[model samples]
Target chain A: MVLTERAREHARALVRGLKAARIEVVASVPDQWIGLILEEVAKEGSFRSVPVAREEEGIGVCFGAVLGGKGAAMLMQNAGLLSSGTGLVTLHLLHQVPLLLLVSYRGTPGDPLFYHIPKGVRTEPALRALGIPYFLTDAGKDLTAQVCRTWTYARESAGPAALLLTADLFAGEDVYP
Target chain B: MRTSRVAYMQVLADLVVDELVVCGLGASARYWKALRPRPENFYLADSMGQAIPVGLGVALAQPARRVVVLEGDGAVLMNAGCLSTVASTGATNLIVVIFNNDVYEASGGQPLPAAPVDYAGLARASGLALATNLEGADAFRSALQKALKEPGPAFLCLRTAYLPDEPIPAYDMRPLETRLIFMQSLGVSI
Candidate 1:
């Protein structure tokens, strides 16, 4: 999907914020909604952009980066969060490793993808079930703050934290053909 | 013509100096623990098929220190997608060694019915720099030496016979404690 200027700017700011926060690795499995953000993150050149085949693998990759004295973040859609459930619980949650997950809030109302609805509804509940603290946002400014907060909480609690990006955030973006 | 698992590990322990090791849960982890009990060795307790991904991350982060993933055949099969992921990252300082035993020895010797996979061929197809399947200890040792020195996202498949005679010792420390110890050893403040 093509990014709206507003969405592009927002993505840039979030990327810059993550870089400023010293996130050295960005592991991702793309979703159309978060594609621009991941693209922007990849262009920055400061972080090691890892494109993973499975979202769960990103969790392992991110945790490994953290162990190697680097901060890491995972970018994916809500379905990825579901796919990564085991890794999140067994590795990060069980070992108390700090991880930052930037997940797209797919299937939220106003998104007509249809299939994403089920996961969208269950995303928050799943996060809560796993005891992961999360912030849902559509505004870029709020995302910046949420990113900072999530990272802080992850380190402080020695657990994983998440930032959920809503579909409304990219309302004006064009879908890729 | 399968190599003894202990012999393979002994060769690995001798070859793996200053490298961070992620041992997949089950026999591979047990073998690694028995061979090398250092803080640099991370014995994964239960996260199957994740050892390679974790090793990939470490390799990317460090870029200089070699990161080795010692995984079992069953574990690798469960998350074979990791090979593609690891290849995509193209980390030069990474090496994945799969212990191919043809069965899920951990789950009580249940045969893996998913058909046989040629791991070295898969790694080559996945774009790793070096890939080989070794049947003898000498061949494995030689290959491992080259794999260590060469720039790589190297892959090695060591055909192994499962001998369940020795019991894997239970790790007294919690997973977090083990992780902290490993990280702290690397001088990363928890």
Candidate 2:
């Protein structure tokens, strides 16, 4: 019922699913607003966390992980997706590396941060063009179920999949999954 | 005018027998077409500057096997951080060679950062043990021999001219057939 309790449950469920699916590496650039679940999941012994210098590097790192026979995930912000341009289409698209980009969306339509508007508006189109399937999570409870389901799709498709979690999802609502 | 793809493959194939050869994506992977496990095992498509980083992880994880990375000029320009990481970590058994094509051959004939960027200098300044720039197969073979002879992170910058498009075999190494043969060679139980 409480926010913290929901976060704890969702975080555990997400990690459990990642573990069930055999995810071994969590490569990420520190993004505060999204993928708080990953921040918690990373602490477990099975999931090796490799802090990356850039989001593109995270994408590449996950690709390398897959090649090495390990499941991998990446954490970044919505704007960070823009930074992931080269790695996304180049490696994930060309080489067929299965990757998941867990992103935090900063600006939605009519939301704050005017600078984010341009990128926010174009985000969906960009993912489609790259053939990267994306979903949105505006509720904290949706994090685990959506993230796990996306992983299934990513592994099936073997390209990058995404969860563009809204900041309000983590900040606003009181419910947890 | 000087060499064939097989020549490069013969030399590199022997070098990478017990090693992890990270192939930079696009046609650069073609040089490694015949190597055991196929090029895709070591291939990172369009992942410029990714081979070295992945090679570092491989070298660190495997410890016993020497690691070789075949990269491109554009790939190097994209992520020079791999050099810095290799320098700081003191990860030996890693060798990076850039097949400097001077252009992004995969997308379009766009100029690469190679003209403006000095890859050898970048490696040296990153505190690499050895960094050499060379042309031709003989020069490359010599560099390849030396890099394999030693056991510290090093880099070679090879200036290769344009390679015209050819129909490369649809190379994919993740199939069960390939994985079985490759893993058994590594003494891995799959």
Candidate 3:
């Protein structure tokens, strides 16, 4: 499914876009596809990756980091999104905090984990409920533009945005191996 | 240690040597529902167990102020894994005060597994210094006051009661916005 290649390409594109925008101080919970990009972001020495224990906490940290004159990004699974719904609704969204919320799309079409399916299928719907906007990366899409678009939306909305990455992006070999 | 939650907040506000991060569900949110004067910038509602870590990040970012986290039992239990990081990190100026009532009161008072779990012991196990579980207002005041005086990355578990059917006080987001605006005005950053 070209998962690894797509994920790597998307990750690199996101880093480049964020760099071009002079955005740094990203925060994220550990995830699959974003791990490679996070390592890259770390190695670039431009982004200070704040490792958070939960996705919701990541939002609060991101808010604080942004107010401290740095932009932030977040990565977690779709279920993590559900787990953080309250924070997103009240604090991040209501308070108008901007950041990228990249969600690894597990339990989608061919997800192996049985439990994640419900939230996986509800990702977009859930985002809609929280007034969050989101986009996704496919192997064939313009990865950099998509990343930049999500970042721009996050900036303009003054709230959170999501970039959903498919499993193939992580499993693919070219970038993250 | 203090008698009421409001009193605890008042003490913390008076002794709150630093900025604050408070997280909880519906019931706990009521603590700040009335919004007395304080330095806390709470990122609450829907997110439980996230305040301490948020406070940790704030501590790392702005080390000058003491960062206090006002957390509830259910909230703290949800992300109890975070306590280890709190203990292991460079948060010399952080404090976590847990208002433990022994149930998921926000979700209708179902007994939490934390009922059997000694959170203060767990905090000690997580390598936190000054971990103690206390009940009653007097114990809260003495313990909390002493805790404030010491140099610490401390944890205090206050076993309080079901916040009785006190009507959910009316709260407006304006107070919070005012604090944010005030912080911005003071060049304190959000």
Task: Give the winner by TM-score.
Answer: 1
Question: How many backbone collisions does model 3 have?
Answer: 13
How high is the CA lDDT of each candidate model?
Answer: 0.84, 0.67, 0.68
User: How would you encode candidate 1's per-residue C-alpha lDDT over B130-166 as one tens digit per residue?
Assistant: 8888898899999999988988888999999876675
First chain of candidate 2, TM-score:
0.82
DockQ of each: 0.76, 0.17, 0.27
How well is each residue in A1-177 modelled by candidate 2, as lDDT tens digits? 133555555556656767776777777766544346666775667676666666776676676556655677877777779878877886666655577677767667434568767878888888888779988864635555677787888878867888776645554353311
Candidate 1 structure quality by residue, lDDT tens digits, A1-177: 445887787787778768766788899988876788888886887778888888998999998898888999999999999888899988888888899999998887756578988998899999999899988775846567667777888889998999888776775645512
lDDT (Cα, tens digit) per residue for candidate 3, span B94-162: 778888777776666788773477989999998896789876766777877776666678788877767
Runs in model 3 lying further than 4 Å from the true structure: A1-10, A21-24, A67-69, A106-122, A138-148, A166-177, B1-3, B21-29, B32-35, B39-46, B103-114, B135-152, B161-169, B174-179, B182-190
Q: After superposition, how far is residue A80 of candidate 2 from its true place, in Å?
A: 2.4
| lDDT for each residue of candidate 3 in A24-121, tens digit (9 for 90 to 100) | 66767666556777877886786766776667777766665554445667777787788888777766676676777778887776454677677777
- C-alpha lDDT of residue B36 in model 3: 47
- Candidate 2 stretches with Cα past 4 Å from truth are A1-21, A34-46, A109-111, A138-142, A172-177, B1-10, B34-50, B53-66, B85-93, B101-116, B124-152, B159-190
Docking class of 2: incorrect
Show pairs that collide, candidate 2: A141-A177, B48-B75, B49-B75
What are the runs in model 1 whose C-alpha is more than 4 Å off? A138-142, A173-177
Colliding residue pairs in candidate 1? A1-A176
TM, every model: 0.95, 0.72, 0.76
